[model samples]
Target: MRIPANRMPTAAAYRPDSRDAGIRRYFGLVQFALIVGVPASRLCSWRHGTHIWVPSPDIQVGDHPGWSMACIDAWVPGGDPFLRPPVVQFADTAAIRARYHGMPASTLWACIGDGTIPRPVVWVDNRPGWLL
Candidate 1:
């Protein structure tokens, strides 16, 4: 399921639109936190150094892993991903992963880790670590 940012706070907040009770059984707070936390933290790397890591503001929601790209290039003026940290809105990534814990990691990784897709570049500003 593709949960757009406008519909949810983060990818973690999404739940599958399935009737299967098993699909709904595994969701929990901890899993949701990890799903949101991993990418959010990765995107925040600009505060420490030059692009330690950064995921796009958009994230794929569901049991399946999906890749993301930034809305704007980091080098463009006022386009830095670090400068614009994704908001911790309602039902974000933390919630989505929790809802779809049963999905296979292989599938998830395949969608998100595909080497063929082009990703936005994330530039780091190390002058002030943790400032952002």
Candidate 2:
């Protein structure tokens, strides 16, 4: 049975051990991609392989299906995905510069390159923003 994407649950609503836990508590492909920082198309292109871990949906939701947070968390390299908090807050270079007035951009870059500053959680567009 096809389920509408809108009717699918969000990641925040998922509870791993709840009685209502099932496909209904999972995230659809689009939502999963957003949470995992991968493109939806890349997720779609995955094929079952011995080395690759692919999450199976407990139930179908319309044309899209969902994967449990537990399953996705397991596939992630780190420890308990939900239990971990972001190590730092992210800010753009300009913000960093403003925070450290009088510091040269070159020095800032050098510090970042030499580990004086923490690296970014991820790059948005072409800008590198650090995680606090």
State each candidate's clash count. Answer: 14, 5
Q: For residues 1-132, what per-residue lDDT tens digits would candidate 2 score against the true structure?
A: 988989865555433435643213445666666566666666656523434345555334323345546556565523332433222335667777777785788988888789976665443223454544
List the lowest-lDDT window of 10 residues for candidate 1: 123-132
> Relative to the unseen true structure, what is the C-alpha lDDT of residue 52 in candidate 2, on a scale of 0 to 100?
38
Model 2: residues with Cα > 4 Å off, grouped in runs: 1-24, 47-52, 77-132
lDDT of 2: 0.54
- Give per-residue lDDT, candidate 2, residue 91: 63
Residue-level lDDT of model 1, residues 1-132, one tens digit each, is: 998867655543443335633321222222333344444343444423564433333322222222222222222322434554452222323332344564453554354468532222221111100101
The per-model lDDT (C-alpha) reads 0.32, 0.54
Question: Using lDDT as the measure, which candidate wins?
Answer: 2
TM-score of every candidate relative to the true structure: 0.17, 0.35
